[model samples]
Target: MEAIFALAVGIMAGAGIYLILRPRTFQVIIGLSLLAYAVNLFIFAMGRLRHGAPPVIDPRLGSDPALYTDPLPQALVLTAIVIGFATTALFLVVLLASRGLNGTDHVDGREPEDE
Candidate 1:
């Protein structure tokens, strides 16, 4: 499971980096999203893998930490996901607006500004 998580993170980072280098606004946005996903996954993976248990303690069974996965990583991942959605939405809006206003979606500007 750990190896799988590591592989996922690596793939995300690699793709993100590749996309980020592209000279297009949309690609940059995708790269950022991928990077965010990788970070979220990495954080979630830090909690370790567990199955068939809830983080909440079962009073009837007594407190045994091993029975549950750490909840902190789960909470962090949830928060990250929400933030990521908002960020992606904002980026998409910006991309659309830029295209509407300038007729181009490249960061280097459709027409070079006079210096």
Candidate 2:
């Protein structure tokens, strides 16, 4: 399971970096989303993976460590997911506006002028 998560994180980072380097606004947006996903996953993974563990503590159990997942990572990831969504929305709106204003979605706008 750890290996699987590691693989996922690696793939997300690799794809995000590759897409971000593209000379198009859409690709950049995608890359940002991908990177955000990778980051969120990485943060959540710090809580440690467990099977069939409820995150909330049960007072009846007299403080059993194995009964609950780490709440800190869950909280952090939730906040990050919300922020990431807002960022992605903002980027999309900006991409649209820029395209409308300049009539192109490419990062550099017009092609280079040849001498």
Candidate 3:
């Protein structure tokens, strides 16, 4: 499971980087989102992977610290998700306005010449 999760993160980060280098503004936005997702996954993974474990400690259970999952990473990831969403929305609004004013969605503000 860990290997699969790591592979997924690597793929997402790689794709995000590739898309970010593209000429289209929309693609860049999507790339940013993908990168954010990859980072969130990485941060979440830092909390350790455990099955059937509660996020919070149960008083009834002895405080061996292994009975519960780390909640810090979860909380951090949740916060990052909210912030990433807002950032993406803002980027979209800017993209639309730029497209409207320039009549193009290219990052360079002009369409590529036909070769």
Best by lDDT: 3
**lDDT of all the models against the reference?**
0.87, 0.90, 0.95
Model 2's TM-score against the true structure: 0.90
What would the per-residue lDDT of candidate 2 be over residues 1-115, giving only the tens digit for each residue?
9999999999999999999999899999999999999999999899998777778887776578777889899999999999899989998998999899888888887545673
Candidate 3 TM-score, C-alpha based = 0.92
- After superposition, the stretches of candidate 3 with alpha carbons farther than 4 Å from their true spots are 113-115
Per-residue alpha-carbon lDDT of candidate 3 for residues 1-115, written as tens digits (9 for 90 to 100): 8999999999999999999999999999999999999999999999998788888888888787878999999999999999999999999999999999999999988898995
Ranking by lDDT: 3, 2, 1
Q: TM-scores, in order shown?
A: 0.86, 0.90, 0.92
Query: Which segments of candidate 2 are over 4 A away from where they belong?
Result: 59-62, 113-115
Residue 49, model 1: lDDT of: 72
Sort the predicted structures by TM-score, highest score first.
3, 2, 1
Each candidate structure's count of clashing pairs: 0, 0, 0
Over 4 Å off in model 1, which ranges?
A: 59-61, 111-115
Candidate 1 weakest ten by summed lDDT: 106-115
